[model samples]
Target chain A: MRQHLKKAGIILFWLLVWQLVSLLVHNSVMLVGPVETIKCLCRLVVTADFWLSIWYTFWRIGLGFLCASLLGILLAFAGAKKLILGEFLSPFFAALKSVPVASFVVLLLIWFGSKNLSFFTSLIVVLPILYGSTREGLANNDKKLLEMAQVFRIPFGAKLHYILLPGLSPFWKSAFSLALGMCWKAGVAAEVIGQPLQSIGNRLYQAKIYLETGDLLAWTVVIILLSFGVEKAFARLLRLLPGEEKKEPDSMKEKGDVA
Target chain B: MTIQVDHVSKFFDGQPVLDNFCMELSDGNSYLLTGPSGSGKTTLLRILLGLTRPDSGRVRLLGDYKYSAVHAGVVFQEDRLCEPFSAVENVAMVSKKLSPRIAREALEKLLPADALDKPVRELSGGMRRRVAIVRALCVPSDVLLFDEPFTGLDRENRKKAIDLILAEKGSVPLLITGHSDEDLGFCHPIDIRTGVPLQMG
Candidate 1:
């Protein structure tokens, strides 16, 4: 409770600073305070279009993220099995990591158009991260444990449940946290460029065109909330997976051994 | 099943770990491998499990085996229990034939009931070693290879563990590597350095 109150107090302090800056500027067009942004958000939430825009962006990006995660895991397994495939795809993933999101957005717009821009953009943005993390996780699995499994002639299903999943958990947790945020930022950017209909990005574009600072800030706030909500929800879902429990710390183990 | 290690030699960095080693492990017998540290005890176990390749010579399985490969239940030098999993999970994970109930019962012989559900990492070294021993015994196999299984175990716990292993081994060839032959008088002692069976007085 104290930690939560401390967080809220910190947020209030920032909000006060923002309000003072806006008042000194004295131009609502250039800057809007937290109050005005909240008021705009309240007005916008009553409209069906607002909800529609959210649904449109949410499902497309969510589906894209889902597809990327699945494909990335499959490809990582394949790559781990085939050394040549891993060697072959190394440069491609490297290029994907380094290429500008804007370049991909523009290219995707030309090829696929605005209808599914967010979907494709988010998929491309998230795939390499999941793939790399999964591959690293596979590489980091304990060789001794694997040898034990092999000697025991344990079935593949049991090996996956007992060994592979637990080894992959930490890597996937960090990768999901990172990829979730990147997919949203890239997905929304793609929508803004493509000017997709019934999208938060489209509204953001419109807000920019008319210089509606309040709407722009309100939409930004919405994006932040949506990103945070999806991350938390995804984390909760990951915790539900079997074999995802926290391991006892090494210090505790050492102390036990000493005793 | 009989394992034939005929003139097997392994070299690492131009040093002979197992120089012209030979041993024939037959069914319904137990062998205790005794050697000083860095005397290729672990390398021999790894060779038997097919985890490492002998630079010269071959290992063969002579038996009326249905499969071409030898299925072994091995306890590595290190406690290779999945650190995040409980002792019961570790034991039961090796084979579907061994249910959680069976695992719990077997573990109760060597470990306390309360430590059965806690993650093996939270357990002491002695407890974790017991979990590894139980895991090896729970699996169905043609042979059992345990390397330094008595590490981190007390005299009482070691006696209990040996009793459990003997009771559960089920006529398979049991090869254990350790430093001393005092606790393992029942097992035929093999000097790993010389690759010869020592006479039991």
Candidate 2:
């Protein structure tokens, strides 16, 4: 309850600032007021194109994020178990992490057309984070627990499920939370630069091109909601996996066996 | 039917823990290894459990390679129970799946039935110690190693935990290290002193 109240207070405080800024700006094109932006949002909601663009941008980026996360986890497991493989991937992952996003996007545009540029860009951008964080999570886990598991003759799968997953969940959460936002932003950026028709990023680019400030503000709101909504959904699923395990602790043994 | 430790010795930074240590146990029996704090009790246990290597000599089981402890179960001094798992799951972790009734029955002797549902992280320190005891005992193993199993438990809880071990794991060739006579009640402890074999002085 305290958290909810804190969040409500922050929202109200920000809305008051938006109201003040809107009144000061006066010119509608220069900055669309929050009230007008909401009105513009409601108007756009009635259109089929807006929904299509939202879904399009959402799924494409969602796919890229999923691909990177799954492969990252798999690679982390491999690298953890095999020192040689882990050493081999060190420089590659390091370079991937240090390389700027703009450079990847520009290079990807040349390799792939604007339509699929965002998809590839999202994959390249999120992979290093997922890899690095999951690797660190695996490496940072308590060695004592692993020794105990070994002495107990725990099966390989059980070790991964019980020992490995719980250890990695925190890192995975942070990695996914951060990577989800980046994928959406970079995916949209790719679309904007590439100007793929019938996409949210394309719509955003068009808004900027014509100086349709109301449309621009409305689209920005859509992007924020999409990104925020998706992240919340992922976090909810994460909370639920452990939540469902809570009601019956013993059942977790079976789940742990499968984990 | 027996484990053989032929002239096994280990040193860390030139300090010997197991200096030409030799011992053997056949079939089902238990031995309490009494030694000073750093007198290789844990190092010996680790070698027997295949988690460490000796500087000289080797451990063999029934004339087999030393990796045999891949089948051994161990209860460490720090109660290496998974903090997020309940008492029952921690024991059931190594057992066959589909909710073994033995797992529930194992914790019944040492922990409250309600604790079977609470994660070990929520349990008190003494409670976690009991859970670790249950885990090592419930799972099948030819051998078990306990490194000072009853260090921090209160007298009453320690006695109860000891009783649970005797009842659950009868004659399991257990190797334990502790100064307390409480553990000696369960088995005859073989004293290993550092500078030389324990003298009667």
Candidate 3:
């Protein structure tokens, strides 16, 4: 309860600061307070364009993220198994990490047009992160467990499911969270640059062009809420796996079990 | 089944770990591979389990077409139970013949009843050691390899572990590396450093 109160207080203090700054500026077109942003969000939520825009951006970005994460994991597994593959892919992954997102957005816009720009942009932004993390996770896997499996002759599939999957869960969870946030940010940025039809990015561009600061703030809040919601849902799903749960021994509760 | 290691040798960083070591053991006999700390007992076992190639020797497992790893169940020098899994799950995951109930019964003999359901990471070292032993013993294999299997067990639990191993490993050849006379019980002891057999009477 104390933690909850502290968090609420921090949010309230930030809101008060924003309200005071907006009042001092005395220009609603240039800056909007939290109340005005929330009102704009309430008004926007009832409109059909709002839902369609969200759906468009969500599916395109979500699809790209899913494809990149799966492909990254597969490539990382292959690379970890074969040293030559890892060596060949290292330079490519490094280049992806270092190159600017705007350059990719401009180049992709020229090639693929606006319809699929965000999807490809999201994939380009997320792949290197997931790939690097998956390879690192595989490299850090417990050698002793692997040797035990080999000595016992545990089948390949069982080793993957029982040992490797569980061992990689922590890395996978962290990578997914990081990649999900980056996917949204890059996807929207691409949509804004490309001006795709019925996208949150298109909405943001329209609001900026009209100088509606309240709408821009409201849409930004929506993006943050969507990102937070997806991250929390995905993390909760991961925690549901049997290997991830931290259950106390039932016998320990009954007394005199360990002693 | 027969395990024949014909003149195996291993070297690391210009140091001799196993120099022309040779041994042979067959079905229905237990052998204790006794050696000093750096005498390559683990190297020999690794060679037998097909984990490492003998620098200049051949290891042949006769009587089955399965690979050496498939034929041998091992309690590794370290307790290598999957940290997130319960002890019963660890045993049952590796064992082809033992169901969870049977694995639990086998484990209860060596591990406390409460520790059986807890993940191996939460269990103490001694408990984890018994989980490793139970996993190796319950698994279906033609032979067993135990490398210092009783390292963390107390006197009582060590005797219980040995008894459990004996009860479960029926008619299969056993190769173990240990210095304790009690752990060797009825198995023929061989000093791996000298490559000579020693009688433990």
The model with the greatest lDDT is 1
Model 2: per-residue Cα lDDT over A1-259, one tens digit each: 9999999999999988997898899888798788889898999999999999988877888888889888877887798789899899878989988888888888888888787777787898888899899899999888999988877768877787678778877887888899989998889988888877789989998888888888999999989988899899997677553312454556878799998
User: How does model 3 fare in lDDT?
Assistant: 0.86
The sequence of per-residue lDDT tens digits that candidate 3 reaches over residues B1-201 is: 877777677888878898777677778899988878978988888888787887787776767656635377788898888888899889888855668898888888887798888778999898888888888887778889999999978898888888888888889899889877785668987888767432223
Candidate 1 all-Cα RMSD = 4.1
lDDT assessment of candidate 1: 0.90
Best by TM-score: 1
Residues B114-139, candidate 2, lDDT per residue (tens digit)?
88878788898878888787788766
Q: Which candidate has the top score in DockQ?
A: 1
Two-chain complex of model 2, DockQ on C-alpha atoms against the true structure: 0.47
The C-alpha lDDT values of all candidates are 0.90, 0.79, 0.86
Model 1 interface root-mean-square deviation: 1.1
Better of 1 and 2 by DockQ: 1
A88-205: candidate 3 lDDT, tens digit per residue: 9978998998999899999999999999999999998889998998998898888988888876778777688678888888998998899999999999999999999999999999
Residue A152 C-alpha lDDT in model 2 = 72
Model 2: lDDT of residue B30: 73
By TM-score: ranked, best first: 1, 3, 2
lDDT of model 1 at residue A81? 90
Per-candidate clashes come to: 0, 1, 0
- In angstroms, give how far residue B5 of model 1 lies from its true place: 1.1
What is candidate 3's CA lDDT for residue A26? 85
